[model samples]
Target chain A: MSLRRLGPVAALARHAVLLASGALMLIPFVWMVSLSLKPPGEIFRAGFSLLPEQWYAVENYSRALTASPLPRYMLNGVLVCGAILSLQIAICAPAAYALAKLRFFGREGLFTLVLIGLLIPHEVLALPLFILAYKLGLLDTYAALIMPFAVSPFGIFLFRQFFKSIPDDIVHAARLDGLSELAIVWRVMLPMAMPAVIAFSIFSIVSHWNDLFWPLIAVRSEQLMPPPLGIMAFKNEEAGSDYGPLMACATLVVAPLVVAFLAAQRWFVEGLGGGVK
Target chain B: MTAGLTFNGINKSFGGAHVLRQVSLDVASGEFLSLLGPSGCGKSTLLRIIAGLERQDAGTVAIGGRRVDDLRPKQRDIAMVFQSYALYPHMSVADNIALPLRMRRLSGMQRLPLVGGLLPGSRTTQAGIAKEVTRTARALGIESLLARKPGQLSGGQRQRVAVGRAMVRNPAIFLMDEPLSNLDAKLRVQMRAEIKELHRRLGVTFIYVTHDQTEAMTMSDRVAVMAEGEILQVDAPQVIYADPANRKVAEFVGSPKINMLPARFGADLTHAAGTTFDVRARELAGTAGTLGIRPEALHLAEAPGTGIFTGRVRLLEHMGSDLFVHLDLPHDGEGGTLIARLLAERAPQIAFGQTLHLGVRTGRILVFAADGRRVQPDPAPAAVLRSYA
Candidate 1:
């Protein structure tokens, strides 16, 4: 129970390794914020300064906001991510419940096909998806941004795992009480699987929010650009010399995800771990 | 309320193998019926089918004289208590018990926390439901534990809440699938009596399933002995134990299962054990049959004589109330053993490897044909026929 029992040299070595790794992870985040707050002149200064000498937070933030349609981009990101998340919950939950509980033909085959989605990279589907979207006249619209991302094979598989862990007797008991299939999913399985749903929600929200490639390919309108695309545009316009406003915009882009994670830390960890199993 | 259940030609198949093959039985109204069998005997499956949790491939299920083959579980007016208790972990015992009522009586908007109270007559209906739940909980002696969750309660308390949930719905039939299987021995025994008493008090038809013969024999008004998805026999517990319809029933019904020694019968009604016993096979003459003698039916004899066989004591298992003696009979096949139960007082001080004489009660002997069916002699005793009836 005592550190001395583990031997001083070995314990010190372990502590040193842990501290070094911790600093390695923290340095980039610290630099991102510090550079965002620094004036343009001090950003690339030779001397190492963890904190900037002159704070240009307000100016950098205003520039970040006004330089591009950051507000509209944020709105679009929220709308698209929200739409995908809602669709995932609505579609994946019942599908998961069916896969876990229902008896039908080709169930295993269907599940295997859904799992095949996990094996295929999203990039591989970009060309075919782009063609399909253009043929359907869904390009330059939120439909293109939200449609393909909404159906998550990973979400279905995660919810299915969580749903399977629930005792079948509980579902049977609910059935005997006269609950419909939808009611059983919503009132019983869904509530019991709250941690998983919350966890998958975070995944779905973050993935769609940070997704740059799909949105870039599917959408051509500037008005429909999400936060990540907007940040790219802002970076391009103020590249080479202006790192302050770029960092500020990057910070803003990551802030919402960090806040969401902080709010749902417990459920996020539980869901992620539980879903994987 | 009394609701009798009838299953007609019930058949179930999984993939290729048939688990239940044309299983049929009738449970009388207000009667406690137990489906007793070994594991994988389809007792639980039959119970689930009755509860509408499982659909039979080919059959008609009727509860209280109405065919419910197409009706959903809730519409069938039947409630089931599962082996795991199946109490909703998230809900309080009160909420769990009241769930059936809430689902049946309350609307979607009426289940909400705030607006539910404002709905027309929702307040009175909710109060009535609560009152009924309280009454049911008090009846089950679980009223004090109602506010607590399932994890907070003891096994027995959770079981009572499960039963209370069934009671609040006032279902026409109660289907219990090994509900007491998860409890400790002492609690299982205690709950067995309580469940039987509850069945009597409620006067609802109860179809209870269990692999434990003792539970089936003690609590049921009538026991249906099943094996491999087929009911071997259905009769009152004492009758089922004393006069089983087949060899399987005779072996399954008793503790220290009936000792089945192969015997060959001559045309003269003389039964020979290992080619040399003087016992009579009467109705079973001229055929090879298995002679089933209950452990308690065989008494320790002093010398070989009529109705007696000589054997050496192989092992002894002493219970406080009885003694189980494994005897190595001369006729017993290569290293095979025959067991006998003796009352503690009458049990002799027998040691292993000691030769002994065993006497079987002729009247208590059971004869099974090659096909596993019980065969009775001509002019069957009135009591035997009466028991069967």
Candidate 2:
């Protein structure tokens, strides 16, 4: 009857909605785990249950590991993501520094171009990038996989915003102390913007590790395929899909990112929060 | 290693708005010169031009009789302590102080992060730099803080570290852009003395920019009063106070502020605030001007008569040593307000609503023309004709 007493009911309602949405997001991952541990007969069973009556986790995991080089795919994912993240930082940090600190002609226009680059989806650039790769004879190679995502507009935007927040006094101080412009980026701006860097690393690793589209179009060799493409090898059209091994591969592929995100959750939040601040 | 600095017609503008307009100043070697002004007066901009941080659109900066317009900030042989004490947040205080030396002493290869320490000859250079950093830190009284990051130190300690960073290189000139403005009042006074002592010990030309008149008056050998992209006056601290070149300089350099009364000048007499005096300035005749009187220049007169201003006492502020008496003038005197400072013990009985006549001695009144330039008093007459009010 009183507004003060209605506070608890309102809070309960808000938490209930949040929990339901959280459950909705988590159901598919839970189902995948359940299916990975179930025998083939139970995967398509009518009754819904969390755990498999018969434990076939070992069999399903072994098949997923050996059937299509799932471990090799995860390794490839690490290599490709590592290379992309490094190249992105190297290219983006200086570009962002220039856009944020330096005064020059056409600077706003160049930054506008970067904003435009953010608006255009990577899927839209696939055809042109694929043709260029073919012309350059970079198809079916790690170069093709690593090169396309090297210059990330979002990374540049994130770093530029972060660099802009830093006072101009520091930049002037560095110059007076005999630091070159590039050295300022390496020694000063990068260290000061560490939170943004960690946040960007997580974003790049997650997006590229799970990226299926570009790798599918560019690389044909199973040796060079990233995790998403490697997992696609589990699907066979001739026979109905093998749900057990497929779900096992999906769980394995998503596991590293989840663990990494959990470990770096603090820096991740600080990094994104720093961008807005 | 010390040098004089000269700004020759320096000019700068941001987006078509002029920030510095043909501003020129000369700081003699070993002199402590302060660029005193309100904010946005382009003092910092001029200092930056000297440091080669910001390029002026026109004019050249010279140091030690050599033109340095084409030189970089590092090549200019000058150092600056920024207002924010812009110490590198990540680097320790030792590393921060050692940076200018390292940049000068080490090759690009030897300055690399991990492998540079292993480079041949770099070890010796680094040892020398370490010795220098420690010496500079000790001089600044921050040797114990060498291992701490700037974020861990108090504001005063950080300012000392910034000064140490500048002083380690032993440059020709030191340009400080309001370095003391960030400290608390007590700390500011303490550091003010320390900085003055540092200047005396180093004997380098210091171009300190500040908006605080007290800092300028106490520390600077000479002060250049600036306003709105122009220098109004440049003289010694005492001369700047006693003999300001313009009305702006008179109003800017004092704490309680010089009181100004609007006046009209006749052929041989000046009339102000219902009182007329035969202080002759024939060149300023037939024009309206301002009569500038400092608070200490005013004294208590016994009664309202010639050579005295009569007003009703509005307020009395007891300042321990001196009492400030605010007076409200009559309607014919343009309803002006005046403040006269009296020795507190001498004027103990002064109360609100009392009528007082304030008198000024001869030659104490500063006359300014309509354009704010000082109007020289006539030198021929040593005589003062008291006001026939």
Candidate 3:
């Protein structure tokens, strides 16, 4: 079936607007890449330029790799994001299933409380979380970086909507087939909810990987710093003029996520509507 | 050994909406019973209660002479085929059929992914499950489809896989909730016959639920008709259709529906629906009632002024074997129209707007009171004769 009807000129006009929007979305990344490839002095000299006059790509990338604990920061970023995403799924999936399917007394009231959580942004809780981490002696530790994001209300809500779309008969059939509620969650519902999980994985990993606010406030040591905080600190300590290595480090830090997203984009894009199909 | 199942005083409510009310039923072992009702009539809910999926608010459910109200669904030794088939899309037909057996026979560790394979004795249990699955699949004639996942199969194939799953358990009872509703008309008929034969071959208690009267009438040993959360009648399919216990059951079980004409019963003669016929009324003569006629009971007369109903043909629908005649009565008060199912060969070049006289056979008229309960008089002649000859 045809989804749209457009005359050739009208379609051309629509494509023009969409192309401009697409270019606009990519402009910052383009500028970052351009600055990363240019000689260190040319970054300061450039008013606006798409390409670098002299390619310092090898030197900038090599230096970015060698400089000041950047690799270790990337490793820590992976560890923190992986831990946070896995923990978020483990905690929220069953909770989401219960919220979507189970018939407890205060199910609605509890879900309302979780919905209210969406209104309270992470920024609102950052101060209290910092204080709590400090009191717990978790400052400068991976726990502080990973622990605050262990339960995402958005993840729970997304999974709950996805789980709700699954027919209740399948769950009842599983029950009659001798599966416990937990077995139904992991073995039955989880497999069916893979698309939702993939979509949520993208959300969790991207958000936690690029997060700078919590990491800057929580970590004091360079050893445990995530890439964003590490690169920001690297800029402060490095002679303020070397913008090439900084952008290159930023590129290195963000590349894994961009590549991973591109690899899984088909399912991620289609599955974002909160269903398997 | 297979055993009978019973629900005593079953009642349930969702918030303030009373869904099932004092529903009590008993099923003999090896009997195929159907709970036929329209949507939201609590037939599905009652079926779930029988399967131990839904808990009754105040009732005792007994399976195999044991009260199973406290038991979990798995403990109840019953299996169900959902209307949606509920086949795990990720699992192959073989795995879908084997799931129940594996869960029952294998330990949690033995059921794991990689570690389960390495565990001792897991191989033997897995082999045994495969054998049983193959046997069940072969029985359902779906052995060729066992290797494919449910997503790859058609609706009828998925239905067979579901039955194979339930069949593998060898449970004491089989509960099916409109299992054929998803299929088209031709497939529904074919699957209905298969289900009936399956019930005969299995010799286990089968409780089926559906809204389709044809399915219930054609397949079940007995049908329990329900409406508004209460059972109206429970009888053999033939009996339920021929002699429904109430107006609701009578109206619900027939195609084109039973033509019920509001009438008055007095002096042992029925008068209404533009036709006057003698009928024995169980109540007093002054009582208001309905005169019910099945479509087959009405036949075309040779001429007007000779038949009970004289009217103009409003519509005609021709089936290959039979024709449907819709007639507009002469004096229409509130009685809308009379519809008759006649053989195509018997209809004489009938057309819309043609005047026709219709005659009802003696002993074919059914009577109901103003409150819509069946009222049969002594020495009634219009009741269906169950021929013993």
Question: Can you give the DockQ of every candidate in the order shown?
Answer: 0.78, 0.84, 0.82
State the displacement of the C-alpha of residue B295, model 3, in Å, after optimal TM-score superposition.
Answer: 2.1
Give the poorly placed runs of model 3, Cα more than 4 Å off.
A1-3, A45-54, A237-239, B300-307, B332-336, B349-355, B380-389
lDDT by residue for model 2 (B283-349), tens: 9988999999998889988888765889999988889999998999998878788988889996657
Candidate 3: DockQ? 0.82
**Runs off by more than 4 Å, candidate 2:** A1-10, A275-277, B380-389
Worst 10 residues of 2 chain A by lDDT: A268-277
Worst 10 residues of 3 chain B by lDDT: B380-389
Better of 1 and 2 by TM-score: 2
The C-alpha TM-scores of every prediction are 0.90, 0.96, 0.93
Q: At residue B43, what lDDT does model 1 achieve?
A: 90
- As for model 1, its CA RMSD to the true structure in angstroms is 4.0
Q: Tens digits of per-residue lDDT for model 1 on A148-230? A: 87789999999999999998999999998777899889888998898899998888888888999898899888899999865
Model 3 C-alpha lDDT per residue in residues A57-158, reported as the tens digit of each score:
999888888877888988998899999998999999999999999998999998998999988989999999989999999998999999999998988898
